[model samples]
Target: MDSCEEGKGIRTLSTVCEAAETAGIHMVPNNPVQVLRFSEAINGNVRLLELNPEVEKSLKQGDRVVIRGLASDEAILCTESKSFEVKVVETSNTMLLCRDIQTPGKEAFTASQSAGGGLIRQEVCGSACSYLELRPCRGHLSRLAEVLSEHQYAGPETEPDNFVAGYTFRDLLDLVQGSEDELWTGLKRCKACCIDGFWRLLSADYFEQAFDRIVQSLAEKDWPIYEVPVDECCELLTDLLPRVIIEHCLTCYGKKNDNGATYCLDEELVSQFYAGYLLRRVAKFNYAEFMEVWQQTVPLGITVALEMLKGIALHDLTARPPVVWHFPANSLPYDVSPRFNALFQERTKWTLSDLRPYIEDLATPQQPLEAILLKHTRSTMDVTGQKLYNSRHPL
Candidate 1:
């Protein structure tokens, strides 16, 4: 039985070792103990859970811990701020769970009041041949595209239809396979908002329009990209779009300035967003023509580079006149095996740089990026060029 906490903010407890260290401590005789396999003993009902120091601390401090997923789906254990994949690992040896077993080293301090005059009978409640282990994992969020895509925020005119879903934040949390922290970040990436009472994804065309308005407004006033007046932009677009949406676009593409009144646009993120918009609308684009248009798409004074498109789009330079196609990281599955297969299916052989961004999220602290690549990919290299990886097995 667990000890009960007394009333008020503080309570008292003691250890057997503390009592043993005290002066004039009386030594009691050890009780005769017997391990009995009770009639209710259920094999595999008990399991050992090993938690990391951080998780233990969080548990001791009364932080929330939840397990998410359907019975058919793989389980994800989530703390308040982090998520981990729950894995079942088998052991060769079996361990039993006994009810009312005395502490192994506290026999000498036990009272002579055993159940039957120092005769202690412990009944086995359960046994286990496996344990549960935790591995760090990115939130399983591919499902977000399905849940929020039902109602896209195209415009205020279409707002009526978009609100039909009526799914709130709690609804998303209940079904989405991510911790609270991961869920918020995923929502931001998907450009989703709690408009009215429902969660909805803002359409790409809408994002493009809002972004263009901001850029053109700055360019007309000859204002530098670094010093964006957030209040003025919000006020101007307040009627056309939600203030939250307006602010969200800015936050996605830029960070706040030190003065705290303005923001500094991140040229790379802005360019990437626009480029992704174009790629998503088309199956593929010619390499030369796409580069020329992409360069023009970004804000003035913001440089565009083919190198910056990693993880967003894949260029088939080996094609005649070359070709570029969208291969976004988000569209891929979260699990490692499927992601690797999808990557190789897109390209038979990929240079390390080209493949890293696609599968980087699958790497964990115990299983790092290099370890993952080595395990799943077959690698070969030239004399001085970058190493190339192919599928470890035939697809």
Candidate 2:
């Protein structure tokens, strides 16, 4: 064995090359250069390993040959069973390089762009949609209904039943804009008829003349004249006119009904000739005051009236005033009272002329006819404990 000790305590040249062959040292085919493990004894020695194949073949047995130009940490072993040993010289310059990089797919990239665009579109659409909602004028339809329901004096009803059908507030406004002349004509006739009805109710005796004057006035004003359907006009007239008369009677005399009798007059009904007489007189010069009184006092009087009518009880009249008396009497004689005579005289005098302006004034403030009817109907029911006005049965 060619044994030798090298730098850094390395041992070299052992008796058996079996271990070296098992370490994977091998020769490349068609190449004279031999590859083997690097050892410290080969340091600074280049000529032996780099020698041509001819010189390697001529090397004598037991010669001390040192390998060169190899890395210090390199190791190789023989692939074959033979104990052939060779020295490593140079290595190949090829190297492997690894790295990581990310790339987005086509679908992912498109979706990102689409999401950004959709957000912008939604914002623009929201801003534009805010102003597109509908906004209507308040009480417009209510006013139209009031005018249509009140106007009683147009010659016989001329328009089709469908004239006011399907009429919304928007439709009424459109109608007002489109045919203002027609609307105004309708309004004027309605106002005239309402005034006429109001006067007649206040004083039943003057009803005929009051109605004629209303028509004549409308004709003079060039308002289209047509007679309203009797059925349609009757209930409205009854409600409005009777209330007016009742209010006038109540204010003129602090009296209330009792057992089919006018305040002081036992033989007279409150609604008979005396109501007309009082309407003609008291409601004549002070029309506005009469209307104010009606509006304020009629509701209360209706409550009282209904109660009295509902609760009739007999009582002795030994100490009461008389039934027959002159106008403006302080008291009635013979079972009648002074207050009753005064009320009868006051309420009977109101004529159409006396009540016209108030009706006109009342008519000017437009309200939804249905809503007005509902309110008045509720009031009547509340006072009378019965439905006096039925919208379903308007007549």
Among these predictions, the greatest TM-score belongs to 1
lDDT of 1 at 262: 89
Q: Candidate 2 residues 1-395, lDDT tens each? A: 22333443433333123444678665222222211233323323222223443334435443322221125422221111111124433434422111211123445334545454111111111111111111111111123434333323222233356343233333443432212333334333222222322211122333333333332333344432222222222333453333333333322332334532223212122222232333444423233333344334321122222112111111122223312111321111211122223323433322233222212221222344344333323223434354333222222
Query: Which stretches of candidate 1 lie above 4 Å from their native place?
Result: 1-52, 87-96, 104-136, 161-166, 317-319, 382-385
Candidate 2: which stretches are off by over 4 Å?
1-126, 129-138, 141-395
- Alpha-carbon lDDT, every model: 0.77, 0.28
Query: Model 1 compared with the native: what TM-score?
Result: 0.78
**Candidate 1 lDDT by residue in tens digits, 175-220:** 8778888888777766677776777877778878877777777887
Clashing pairs in 1: none
Least well predicted 10-residue stretch by lDDT in candidate 2 = 120-129
TM-score for each prediction? Answer: 0.78, 0.16
lDDT against true structure, model 1: 0.77
